[model samples]
Target: MKILLIEDEKDLAKSIQDYLKTNDFVCEWVTDFSLALEKIALYDYDCILLDLMLPRGNGFDILSHLKKLNKSDGVIIISAKQNLETRLEGFNLGADDYLVKPFHLSELLVRIQALIRRKKFDGNNIITFNEIQIDLLSKVVKVHGISIDVTKKEIDLLLFLIGNNKKVLSKEAIAEHLSGDMADMIDNHDFVYAHIKNIKKKLKNAESKSYIKTVYGLGYKWEDE
Candidate 1:
């Protein structure tokens, strides 16, 4: 999954980023409100980690902008400041969860996982589509009760496709989701084709139904046959 972490503390942000990476999550971080504003305005994230205190501006301003845009990105407020009023304000401004500073990285991971599960799979860690079953917590994919050897990147690609269901996903979108903002610098998204091909092969080997469809001149979509 991809997360946008809007935090100002350099050490803490790096620690969070490094921790998230070890768990197979892509976390893009911004230290100031201006960049946070731009990221929320332009891109979509599985979840957002917002620090209430920032340089030049506060998290509330960024939260307000997100609310105005009506983005579905799940948000968790992380701040040293704690109170009922602040908590209520964060919720009123579209925050999904809150975590105080001096928190455990493991606890933060659990929170992010729960939030993403709620947002994507309606609070279920297991994603089932026909014979395919993906256990998010264990990072396992099974077909007909048989385990498949799916890589982490392949798992990410599979989730992205299944989460969108029937929506057409452009190669650019796939690349950006898998590679973050760095995708914008690349002239080709052909690597996305490779990921798709691998998933297709694995699913076929496991005797799963074909769900991913190429849209010819457009992109790809997960459609029921």
Candidate 2:
């Protein structure tokens, strides 16, 4: 999933970014509230980690801006404020979860996972489509009791398609979802086609019906009907 972490603390931001990257998540971080606002305006993030206190602007302002945009971006507030008022205010502004500083990174991760689960999958760890079952928490894919051996990107691709089933996903959109802003710098999105091909090959090999279709001159869609 794509995560935008807006924390002004340099050390903490770097640590969190490094840790999340190691855990198979694409994370973009900004230390300034202005930068955070720009990112939120320009991109669609699966989740946002927001710290209430920022140098130029407060995180609450960012929250209000997000609401104005009608963005369903899952937000987790991480701040030093442990008071009830702050927590309540964050929740009032539509924060999915709140975590205080000086907490374990593990705990923060757990909360973030829970928030993502709630926002994206309705708190389900397993995602199902037809005969295919994906254990999101474990990162496993199964087809008719047979486990599939797939790479991380393969699983990401499958989940993205399944989540947006029946919707056409542009090559640029797919690349952005998988590779974040770096997608724009690439010379080609042919890699997306390669991933699609691999996914189709694996599913077809397992006697599964192909659900992905190409929209010539446009993009691809995950349509089963």
Candidate 3:
């Protein structure tokens, strides 16, 4: 999943980024409020880790901005300020969860996963589409109760496709989601095709129907038909 960490503390931000990367998250860090605002306006993130006390402004303003834009990206307030008022305000501003500083990185990782689950898969750790079942916690895919061996990237792609369901996802979007920060550096998105092909083969080998559809001159979509 893609994450935006809006934090001013350099050390803390770096630690968070490094830890999240190890967990297969595409993490981007922005120290200042302006840069954070710019990123939130342009890109879509699965979860956002927001620090309340920023360089130029309070993180509450960022929440307000997200509300104004009607962005449904799950937000977690990762602030040092631990008070009833602050926590209530964050929840009032549409934050899904809040975590105080001095917490474990492992906890933060699970929190991000939980928020993304709530947003994308309706609060379920296991995602089901017909005969296919994906265990979010274990990162495993099964077809008709039989386990299918797949890589992490393929599982990520499967979730992306299934989450969007009938919506058409462009190659650029899929590239960005899969490659994270390196997406811009990579010139070709042909890898997306390869991943799709492998996923199709695995599913078909398990006696599952082809649910992934290609839209010529556009992109790909997951359809029941």
Candidate 4:
């Protein structure tokens, strides 16, 4: 999954990025509020880790902007502002969850996963569609009860496709989702095609239903047969 962390503390941001990357997440860190707003305006994230206190702006304003844009990206306020009023303001501004600082990384990871699940999969950690099953926490994909030997990127692509089932996802969107805001920096999006091909082959080999559909001139979609 991809996350935009809008935290100002360099050490905490680096530590969070390292830990999240180890768990198969593409984390993009922004030190100031302006950069955070730039990212929010440009790309979509599965979840955003926002800090209320920033050098350039307040995180609450960011949340307000997201609401104004009608963006459905999940947000979690990770702030040192621990007062009830602050927490209430966050949720009222469309924050999904709140995490106070001086907390455990593991807990933060779990919260991110949970928020993603609630936003995308209707609060289910284990996603089940036909014979395919994906455990978000364990990062496992199984077809007909058999685990598939797929790379982490492939798994991420699978989740992205399934989560947006019945919706056509453009190549650009997929690329950005997998690579975060650096999608445009990549030389090309051939890796997106490669991952799609590999996932199709693996699922076919495991006897899973063909659900990924190609839109002739558009992109791809997860359509039911």
Candidate 5:
């Protein structure tokens, strides 16, 4: 999943980024409110970790901006402000969850998963479409009750495709989702094609239908046949 972390503490932000990365989350981080505002305005994220104390502006303003744009990105207030007023203000501004600072990274990870599940999957950890079953927590894929040997990236791709269903996803979008902050450094989207090819081959071997369809001159879509 894609996560935007708006934090001012450089060390804390890096630690959070590194911890989330190890759990297969694409995290883009900004240390100031200006950059955070720019990112939230320009792109979409599965979840945002917002700190109330920021350099240029308060994180509550970011929440107001998201509300103004009608963006539904799940937000968790990771702030040092533990007062009732601040918490209430955050919730009133549409924050999904709250996490006080000096918190455990593992707890934060689970919170993000819970928020995403509630937002995207109706609080279900298992995603099933036809004969395929994906366990979000275990990162496992099964077809016809048989397990498939797929890499983490393959599972991520599968979820990305299935989550969007019939929508055509551009290579750039997939690349950004996969690479996070390093996406700009990627000169070519060849890795996306490679990952898709690998996922298709593995699914085919498991006797699954060809759900991933390539749109010529465009991108790809996961269609249910």
Candidate 6:
């Protein structure tokens, strides 16, 4: 999943980014509220980790703006203030969850996963598409009752495609989802093709139905029917 972390503490932000990366999540950081506002308007993210106090503007304003725009992106308030009023205000503004500062990274990750499940997958840990099954928590894929050993990126790619079945996903989106904002600095997206090919080969070997279809001169889509 893709996450936008709006935190001003550079060291903490870096640590959080690294932790999420290790756990198969693409995270982008935005210390400046203006830039963050622009990004939230332009692109869609699965979740937003917002800090109440920011450099340019407060996170609550951004949250209000997001709601005004009818953006359904999940929000998690990560602030130092742990009072009831702050927490209530966050919830009133439509925050999916709230986490206080100086918390464990692992705990934050768990909360994020829970929020995503509640928002996107109806709180299910396993995602099912036809005969194929994916365990979101374990990051495992099974076809026809047999386990398929695959790379992390392969699982991420498959999950992304499955979630957006029948929608054409461009190479750029795939790159960004898999590699975060740093993907933009890359020269070419040729490596995306390699990952797709590898995922297809694995699924084929498992005797599962081929679901990924490449759109000519565009991108790829996943559809079971």
Best by lDDT: 3
Q: What lDDT does each candidate get?
A: 0.92, 0.88, 0.93, 0.92, 0.92, 0.89
lDDT value, residue 11 of candidate 2: 96
Report residue 158 deviation for candidate 2 (angstroms).
1.4
lDDT digits (tens) for residues 1-225 of candidate 4: 999999999999999999999999999999988998899999999999999999979999999999999999999999887999999999999999999998899999999998898899999989999899998878899999999998889889999999998999999999999998788999888888888888999999998888999897688999889
> Which regions in candidate 4 have their CA more than 4 angstroms from the true location?
none
Cα RMSD of all models vs. native, in order, equals 0.9, 1.3, 1.2, 1.0, 1.2, 1.7
Global Cα lDDT for candidate 3:
0.93
lDDT of 1 by residue, 16-59 (tens): 99999999988999999889998888789999999998988999
- Over 81-184, each residue of candidate 3 has an lDDT whose tens digit, in order, gives 99999999999999999999989999999899989998899999999999999999999899999999999999999999999999999998898888765787
Better of 5 and 6 by TM-score: 5
lDDT tens digits by residue: candidate 5, 40-137: 98778889999999998999999999999999899999988899999999999999999998999999999999998898788999999898999999
Is 1 or 5 the stronger prediction by lDDT? 1
lDDT of 4 at 97: 96
* Higher-ranked by TM-score: 4 or 5: 4
Q: What C-alpha lDDT, on a 0 to 100 scale, does residue 222 get in candidate 6?
A: 97
Q: How accurate is candidate 6 locally (lDDT)?
A: 0.89
Candidate 1: where is the Cα deviation over 4 Å?
none
RMSD of 5: 1.2
Tell me model 4's lDDT, rounded to 2 decimals: 0.92
